[model samples]
Target: MKTAPARPEAAPAPAPPVRRARARRLLMCRPTTFEVSYAINPWMDPAVPVDAALATAQWERLYRLYLALGHQVELIEALPGLPDMVYAANGATVVDGKVLGARFRNAERAAEGAAYLDWFRAHGFTEIHDPLHINEGEGDLLTCDSFILAGWGFRTAPEAHREVEAVFGRPVIPLELVDPRFYHLDTALAVLDGDEIMYHPEAFEPRSRALLRRLFPDALLADRADAEAFGLNAMSDGLNVVLPRAAEGLARQLAERGFNPIGVDLSELLKGGGNVKCCTLELRAPALGQ
Candidate 1:
């Protein structure tokens, strides 16, 4: 009788890739005068009472968290009349030391663009473009690895996408937003790392959804509950992800991908139709020696 051949040992499961958190220079504003006085988007309701104190408290925590995470936090003095200035991400879009100033669609936020541009000028940013077309800054224009993902059918005009491409010297892919609730692209989608993105499909038009699928096949799909919770309005420093605390489902998905998701209670700020990413403006590659 011949001895049976021994079976080969099974290979061990591969370890997940370790995520690295890169320090970022972020700009934010204190929500000292935050209010829902005007209905700019679906989230804002004048009938609903806003706790200005609570909004300030929540924003402070987020600001401190950024500092604790080894990120540089810069403050822009909030103007008295502009209640929506707290959404600093709407002020401007900075990339590779180039600044493309925002041009708001609604008159309510018109002055915010100049206010942010002033800060950049004071800080020694020379390559700044005051856009001719209407754009909502980082609110509708998000940077991927080598290109920019622009949003339209809401606040930002399609023409602004071309302006951004010309200003940043990168290809811009425009995605049309269909749902009123997800007015800003930042509200419906988030850039996790490099070209990795997560978004809610229903927020985008059918054609835009198809485009997103083609571009990022492995993108995380958020459920309605998470999307409504403003889960997709998240900020990532390559590894650590800061998002709304209500987005528990999305947090778990991020953890599975080897990310550290820091959930924060920005419910007070949500009343103003903004959250984590809305309050954060990343100043990418500021002019050296300035």
Candidate 2:
């Protein structure tokens, strides 16, 4: 019998370069007419109504606004007994084709993380992970094409910031959120069309403010009054912005810049402490991938 020729060794396969997932669509949970922990705790505000009818109406308006902006909205059923669950945006972060479930800093908001994980699994997203360190989802993350700016202090810790950097393999700038009122990074800042950022100066440290200005020299400084009215941190889809109905002046500014502003009345939601950007969680966006 002829001896068998030796098999040629197999070439090693090259490892695939990691790619960050881009958020093109999003998920938003409308606030129900329930008492949010913040609104009830410490001291209740009698003026803020938590009746089901009013909350439902406000959420419907918010839904219409998101739909008008060309977003594929996924509405979640109200979680009975969990008021903060309405702020679903604070639940998770999508990066590098993986969903990182949050570990909320606020005890009242902790249940939101588990809800996010459940949603991820149901949507067929198998690459889900969570940081061992305390962090509160996309609220702490502000991602651009090159870097992710994470806020630490109230919602996310310094240790969580470092862990996020390791997971993304990119630069993570740690920002100290000095103001407790504006708990998350998104509450104080947002990136709009053309790399322009809308931010509130009073919410950031002087050094952090300077760094932001340097990053986007052309960034328009939104007025304090407008910022307070939810004009500064509005969500944009390159063509339009979902803003507060009362922000007509800011809308005019955006219109001049070629953006169509669609206003939504989130009065009740705002009273509970947030607006459109705070209510909606962007799962992926185009700018995230360079």
lDDT of each: 0.94, 0.71
- lDDT tens digits, residues 118-167, model 2? 88889877778866988877777877656787887777889987788877
Per-residue lDDT tens digits of candidate 1, residues 118-182? 99999988999999999999999999896799999989999898899889889999999999999
Error of 2 at 260 (Å): 1.7
List the candidates' TM-scores in order: 0.94, 0.82
* Residue 187 in model 2: lDDT: 73
RMSD of 2: 16.1
lDDT of 1 at 191: 95
Q: In model 2, which range of ten residues has the least summed lDDT?
A: 15-24
Candidate 1 local distance difference test against the native:
0.94
For each of the candidates, the C-alpha root-mean-square deviation to the true structure, in angstroms, is 2.5, 16.1
